[model samples]
Target: MTMVSNEYGKIITIEQAVEMIDDGCSLMVGGFGGIGSPPSLLQAIIDKGVQQITLICNDTAFPHIGVGPLVAQGRIKKAVVSHIGSNPIAGQLLHEGKMEVEFSPQGILIERIRAGGAGLGGILVDIGVGHEWLAKGKPTVDIDGNRYLLERPLTADISLVYAKKADPFGNLIYDKSARNTNPLVAMAGRITIAEVEEIVPLGELDPEEIVTPGIFVTYIVQSNGVDWKWIWE
Candidate 1:
């Protein structure tokens, strides 16, 4: 593959991008199941044998989809996710005491990530007030005669994201529902790597269509496309 570069010099190969992620690092992945996930990047990580990862994402996806293969292969030490029902391996690992799982409400999970990107300490919400599982060990705040749980902001050492199109500068556009959590996750990482199906020249993308600005992306890798057959099986 020819090296794509711009004045910002953010474009890089998948191997070079994955090298930035060390063992035991916190990783925030953007996707709703397999839709928006960066398959080539995730597969590269698996091949690199990076271990003890703390994965933060919306769901575990299916065993052969998205981040689920990482979870199934025991690559993750802990997972902070909204749901793991789609991937039985995650449940099995949790039950077998091989992995740690933190459950977060879908809305709150993205909000917490948003807060991290915005550089806020945390956010207060009442969604899990009376639920023991959600409220356990959490600090409560009282205001206007009501109590709310203080959900701490979440940030990651590295974030992996998939985009439908991106410029060399990393301005990104997602395909429909695949955009879920990617914009938020893009901002919350110290180093954000975006795998894109197409990399257009700078200024070719309309400003209004770019969901994630180039400033939030540290690197951009060309994608090798995902095989959707995994989903049907």
Candidate 2:
């Protein structure tokens, strides 16, 4: 079989994209309650059964959607995320000592990812300065008597994102609230794979509308399969 040599210019299959990942990888998944999650790519990853993956996402979503299946499948060894309220599977796994979960404030979490993309060491925020349990030995600095905790950058081996539209060069546009967290996740990965609903010609995407430039995207996959509906949806 002839492989597509230029990942940015052409669309790759879900299998091709999934095969790029390895076991024990740190991954950033873009979504908020399954809105911008990459279902086909995730299903591919689930099929691959890559174990010990550490996922960073806004939420775990439902047990059958987004990163929840990975948790239910016992593939995720650790997760660094903002909330697990939507998915009881994550909380159950954590309680069972089957998985480890790291909590983060939404703003602080995104800033850490942004810092990594910008090549910054970290950012200072007072979000958790007073909570000694949350500080966990992080050094604090006083800015003229006010104190703040230093939150370090977050980078990942792989990033999975979903887009409403993408050009052949991988420039992306997202649909409404679905755009949440995807742009940042795109930049924080060493290898970013985008799952897009539509792939158009290289010059078709409007410059201003493209939230994520193709420069940050390493590969592209056309969206496939039926949409996974949440239990509440």
In terms of lDDT, model 1 sits at 0.93
**Top candidate (lDDT):** 1
User: lDDT tens digits, residues 44-158, model 1?
Assistant: 9999999999999999998888998999999999999999999999999999999999999899899999999999989999988998987998999999999999999999999
- Give every collision pair in model 2: none
TM-score to true structure, per model: 0.96, 0.93
Query: Cα RMSD (Å) per model?
Result: 1.6, 3.0
Local error of candidate 2 at 20, Å? 1.3
Provide the overall lDDT of each model, using Cα atoms, as 2-decimal numbers. 0.93, 0.87
Ten contiguous residues with the weakest lDDT in model 1: 1-10
lDDT string, candidate 2, 60-121, tens digits: 88788878888888898889888888888888999999999998888888998989887899
